[model samples]
Target: MTAETSEPPAFLPGLELSRILYEEGVRPVLDAAHPGLAYAAARVGSGSEVLGFDTARSADHEWGPRLNLFLADADAAALGPAIRELLAERLPKHVRGWPTHFRSDAGNELDPVSGHMTATDGPVDHRVSVDGIGSWLRRQVGSPTAELGPLDWLAVPQQRLLEATAGAVFHDGPGTLTAARARLARYPDEVWRHLLACQWQRISQEEAFVGRCAEVGDDLGSAVVAARLVRDLMRLCLLIDRGYAPYGKWLGTAFARLPVAGRLTPVLRGALAATTYPDRESRLCEAYETVAALQNATGLTEPVDPSCRPYHSRPFRVLHADRFARALAATVTESALRDRPLTGSVDQWVDNTDHLTSSRLEVPE
Candidate 1:
């Protein structure tokens, strides 16, 4: 039998579909097949659902009825293939009218099996991935756990780190995978403070250029600098909130959820929408004060003044963000981390997804 529906079906969220597949399909079959197989199941890695941003538009490809079933290395080596084959035969053809098999041809067009839905006969190229946890972690992030040092945390992109920890786990029988996830959830405290300091340093480096560019009669350049500062400020807020900032597509979405977003959004928006340099500078100053207050509230460092001031010797009005940087850096007790330059994490310095996504990313010593 084939898998198809009468008409275009309403959108189903990936997380819900994954849970249903695990409870109704995979769990029963696993119980009957091996009786006591130990495995973990989750819907995670590189999807909007993992990030809680999936929508109807995300249903096209690489979506629907998909999950990761992680087994211990030995269990995976022995029963992986048999379980995969068994699921192809026993699993339901459709979960909430979406196909169990996700078929993509040369042009990447998704074609679900086109006829009747059946339990025993359907396409065999199922979306469920069966693997060992170690292999999965190595595949997802370069390391199996967050035993990462300062440089290791810097090298891995925040997007990758976010993906490594974002989604929901349906079940973890042995709990190894769950434990691994907890370890990978966030950077160590020292690393977080180091990155936070570096982020403020980034703002300090460019905060003066907004007015300097305007002084040179470069309104466009001034606006550009202001926009850059706005992004840095948003990211800094995310860091203060102890949240991972996703890439550009979801950056605003994620930022909106921050505690300070309500007060800061308008100021940031004004900074970006300002055409004149004075207007831009004024709006950015407002943003600076707001974020500085957020920093003070965190009590991460002794509160620095949340007001903008002149960049010394230059006529530019700015926050002199290095003050905040220095305050945060002072709290870092790790000698190695304290001595390192303030480059922050991969996402802070690099905007290109291609470079950030590379597994071989080099961390500066």
Candidate 2:
């Protein structure tokens, strides 16, 4: 293509880019080189696009026409490298005008995943990956398959789980990829109840702190506590809907898509925007009551009163969040999870990037 025709492709969502690359570029190469190969192809994991919140700005780094290609254990071991090299030799300079290559000769092989898509005439250093589905699963969720136990769920991060399950799955020729995504889509009911309880327990641990901090003339600390509660409440709404919450970067974006965001957003914003402790308390209590009522509506357990009252003569209003915590915890019947403390999942207690993003990063019991 001429320089005039070679300007960077206008931004398409990364998932769409993956689709175009597969259909237009990768498929023919695979069909001719290894026909009848049993495999699954998808754009799952890592990128903001996987979670459907990527924008043009996302094109700036680690974004491109790329996807995961899964094969059976035998097929992956025997043919994976061949297929990867074959794509590099035959895939086009661009898939829908976005270069199919993610690395250049000048590129540092040790440079980490910059995801910088660049045009190339030599054998294209394309980003299509070919792997055994089991290996991929182990990297994504610390397992070889999607069947995770309760303790396993607690050890995995929601962000990792979201990445594993949220993105578009484009093909199911091997049949397991679709099933894997479905299995990991949400937690089991008992685990759900346990997590909901822990989330409420998180709020309870802090609801009184908001006012207490302000009373001690630490308005900043009060706001900080209020903000944490707001986040917990948002994540709680995600759990109530049986959806996985993304990490902090996209937490609000994911939360906004939830059914409760319309009612809760205003209250949450009011709490954050409040200038005084009384206003913060008033707005936060409204949020607590709203979410408390939502929990009751789920019928997860016997209804706890959703109204706000003073924090046991401490002059701060609260929903007595532990009541909701206890109520939800009562419904869990899974013996492994039953009577567990309020630690919730790894995401509930751990937010380190290195820890959260690692598949084998086990959390302490």
Candidate 3:
């Protein structure tokens, strides 16, 4: 899903109500009839509602009475019919104030059950599987072999990925969700190291280009660089701190709520608003030191002073030039990018990142 079909409803309101239905309306049925079928948990994963960041404006269609049911494949297959029958007969006509806009067929589109239904919504909106940890692990981190390919990491929008990937898991039985969570909970240690290395390289590469952009008589473009610098800085913070950067809409919301938000916010804004290349350079250097301090306090990584100094030279700054070359060659995954070598194009870099984080598509791979 590119930027177009990425609108997800918030999670709490919908999740709370769905949990109620699962425990009271649905769980009892599973306990009585499908006792042999294990009950792991029910959760709401994708959508804005799950992220606790949706506004009232988010309530449109396909935004109410949804729940995900996870069971072993055999259990799901064996008890699928019974569960659906129970949902049809006993599942409340509506949850809280919202109608169970249950669509007739799991495959129904558009007017998809505005209310309630089984987890497996056939082609789209299928309840996720929690039968085992491996399956859930693949879904969470988005391994290519696990139904969805590696999220185009480079192309999918960040906000949508955050919304879909950051929701709550509500309930669980087998702890399959728990194990999978530990893996996808954050980037693996090696992956984080690689990304941090890449990000640092990126800033180094552009350090020399600040003047070039300024020379083009585009203060706006220079400002854009500053903004990008701020973004990367924050992303590094999240990574170093072991948090996934949420979608754009909820970035400030998410960032402000972090423990370091108070400290980092002012620095981030300062970098973004810096007017001159030298000023930006100084601000970023400060940002790096601040990040290093935080990393030390948290024991996230071993401290190492950056070899590159603040940009002070004008023509073909050696450090800046070297860092740029390194950043260009440090890509972790190609899923998000359209072209193999990004060529220092900001638009392409952002575009590819967005694509890589999008939700799994409906059409078969």
Candidate 4:
């Protein structure tokens, strides 16, 4: 992003740019310096491009030709530094018209290591990260072993899980990255059901509040409750399809790709846009039934009527979503997870970035 060049190269998607970097810039260096060196190369962690949703504007920072180069534990310790040094001496000044050299994105901030693109004549400080797959996975999901327990799955954030699984793997010479990705691709059956039940439990707790707030003449409170339910419903749809919901910045972008988004989007928007209580209740009820039917179609549990009924002793219409929650919970066969509380995972109850990013997150018993 340095002005040393007239301007940065016209934007190419980040994943594709990373692929070109490996093939043209990094591969030739490896092929010559350490022939037959076994490694796995990929663009699999922490970037908008990894998720295939990055736009032209993403080029501003933390967006360029970058990828993870994974090696065996022993090789990583023995040769990682040498490989990095070799790339620095040999990689082209430019690849596909973007600078191979990089510098810190922060103009005045600390952390001096270069992390963004800029033109340079000196040995280009590059971003070809080197480490073992196990170490990388351990840093990512807290468990180094391939076999992740139920508690392990609960501890890792959904966003991190998405980062580990979404991006393309250009090579797997170590013969383990693909398997590792597949293993982390989705939650186990029992855990998924538990998540579904907990999502429904969330809705059951609040679906009546949209109407009750308006009943008490708190239009603002009613609108706020309606928006919260809309968000929960969207997250539930994501769970139903087995997609990991990204952080709030990209939740709707991810949800828009779901099969149910076509019909569900309008009902959800209607609920969010409603000013009066009647319109909010009507749209919310429509959404409730739509999602309920979608859940029933999965055949995960006994089908509950997807109809809206009055909240007991009040005129507010509700889905009594606990019917879905209890039915799904009944189908859980995993003894460790059965009869557990409705909290699904760390991300379910907590949204703190510091906690979500930590690899040492403790799972509650």
**lDDT value for model 4:** 0.87
Instruction: Give the candidate order by descending lDDT.
Output: 4, 2, 1, 3
Reference-based lDDT, each prediction: 0.81, 0.86, 0.52, 0.87
The pairs that clash in candidate 4 are 103-115
Number of the top lDDT candidate: 4
TM-score of the candidate numbered 2?
0.95
How many clashes in candidate 3?
36
User: What TM-score number comes out for model 4?
Assistant: 0.96
Candidate 3 residue-wise lDDT at 345: 21
Give the per-residue lDDT digits (tens) of candidate 4, residues 245-347. Answer: 8878788999999988999999999999988899999999999999999999999987899999999999999999999999999999887789789888887
TM-score ranking of the models: 4, 2, 1, 3
Residue lDDT tens for model 2, 1-365? 22434567678889999998888888888888888988888999898999989998887567888888999878899988888888888888887777776654355667555656677778878878898999888888878787888898888888899998888888889789898888998998888999999999998888999989999999999999999999899999999999988878899999999888988899999999999999999999888888888898998788789999989979899888999888888888899889688888888887677788777856457
Model 2 lDDT at residue 24: 85
Comparing 2 with 3 on lDDT, the higher-scoring candidate is 2
The prediction achieving the highest TM-score against the true structure is 4
Candidate 2 regions exceeding 4 Å error are 1-7, 104-113
Q: Candidate 3 lDDT (Cα, whole model)?
A: 0.52
lDDT of 1 by residue, 199-263 (tens): 99999999999998999899999888888898888888888888888888889999999888888
The C-alpha local distance difference test score for the whole of candidate 1 amounts to 0.81
Q: In model 1, which range of ten residues has the least summed lDDT?
A: 111-120
On residues 122-237, what C-alpha lDDT tens digit does candidate 3 reach at each position? 22232322333344434443442232323323222334334434556656676665454443445444344444555555665555555578777777787787676667667656
